[model samples]
Target: MRKRLFILGLLLIGIFLFIWINNKWIVVSEYTINSSDMPAAFDGVRIVHLSDLQRTSFGKKQLPVLEKVAAAEPDAIFITGDLVDADRFKLEPVLTLLNGLSEISDVYFVTGNQEISKDRAEEVLSALKRTEITILENEKAKWNREGETVYIAGIHDPLMDISTYDPLIDVNFRNQEIEYSKRARDYTRESLEEVPFTDDFTFLLTHRPEMIEEYAETPADLVFAGHAHGGQIRIPGIGGLFAPGQGFFPELTEGVHEFGDIRLVITRGLGNSSFPLRINNRPEVTVVTLEHEEVTGLNK
Candidate 1:
């Protein structure tokens, strides 16, 4: 009887482990939304959005997971925030991986709370200087793909220090730093303000999903974010268990939510945080396809 009980316990444990890994990997949840702003030339363009990858939390298995995503062959790749593991984990290999992804699709990056340069500001600055990836800081990149030109706007995580200057204030004129979110928005807004009003479509890249409420009122057709980590553990019906910002349950925890005239998508990301990992909330990448239309109610 004792032996039988022990064997049953072991079986249960194995089953639980299997379930967890399957949820963590294997299951890649996808989100697809329609943007009336998409140009006719690139109507079905597929974009893969990745977020909240705390490198320290994920194991060796993550690389193969990422490679699988690359195989999907997305036209554009957008990374929202927290790529580095709270400024400690070596981001070199991650950078190298991103560099390789450049061959697959045009990749873009934005900042996150973890990307904040509060601790080693100088170090982060020096490293970003070497990357070929377009780190959108309150700027817009115009792409002429599929015989149509479209605009993609990028905003760094609102909880970080975004400075165009590196080693500029040698006088130690610190303490003038503004709220991270405000800084991110002002700069990103400045970037998109210059885009032609008639551009094919404009999508925003922001790290914190909290900014969606404000950005939705803007001209953006859709805004993407991923800082919540899907509350690390989601509860049924009630949705995300607990989100950091906005208190209680955040509206933009995961999946899709609509703001005034824009759509918002919050990715669960590809790694873990807070509790070091997730439960039912599997890490994922979103492939958003845009379509053109002569329709109204663009939420603009």
Candidate 2:
């Protein structure tokens, strides 16, 4: 009986280990976003969205991750945020991944919670600029193909203020920081105020998905976000169990969510943070192909 019980225990441990290792493996999730606002010249254009990598590396020099991205043939690459792990002192892994990715295509970046947290702000920003990756913070970039243009814009995470230049700040400081979500909206609105509303299809890049409600009201046609980490753990039928900004069973945890004409695509993210592993959730790199819809019937 003792021998049998010991064997069973070992088997159980093996099974758990298998599940944990497999879950940590990276996976690519592809999505096609069709919009009538998309210019005809932009059809079939691929934009790879990577978010919340948090300094995780896949193979030496991030070869595996880069291989997958290069295979997709992305016309542009958008890294939403959290390229570095918050607790990590070494940024080589993050820089290695960035340098590898930049070789593949145009790499755009924005701030995440980790990038701004605990005295890492300047270091993170400086490294990104040094790599020559375009930093889109409350700004827009125009991508022209065949004489048609699309705009890509990005915003700084609200935590950019909370985590910078203050190590002694308390929980109340965080609460005060979150309040800046409103300010983020105002900034975006003001920035785009001069640009005509129908000028082009504006894609907004933000770190936090929880601010989707506010972003929906902006002039942005689409928003890309990643900060939930797929709620840390997702259950089959029940969906994401919990997320930092959205709380338990958060509604905006992952996938594409729409509010009227404004669409928000939230990536499950590329790596982990506080939690060491995810159960049903695997690391993700979202590839979005933009398709143009022809106006017909009353729309014409």
For residues 1-300, write the lDDT of model 1, one tens digit per residue. 999999999999998896567346634556666655576777767788888767643345356556756776788888887777753567675676676667677788877767774454346545764776777776678878767787777765544446443234544434333343456666555544544443347778888777655576567777888888777677777777666554566666778887666788888777765566566777776777666655657655
Off by over 4 Å in 1: 4-12, 15-23, 56-62, 161-200, 294-300
What tens digits encode model 2's per-residue C-alpha lDDT throughout 38-72?
89999999989898888566778888788889999
Clashes of each: 5, 0
lDDT of each: 0.68, 0.81
Local error of candidate 2 at residue 205 (angstroms): 0.7
Residue 151 error for model 1, in Å?
A: 0.9
Q: What is the lDDT of candidate 2?
A: 0.81
Cα error of candidate 2 at position 58, Å: 1.8
- Name the candidate that leads on TM-score: 2
Please report, as a residue range, the 10-residue window in candidate 1 with the lowest summed lDDT.
172-181
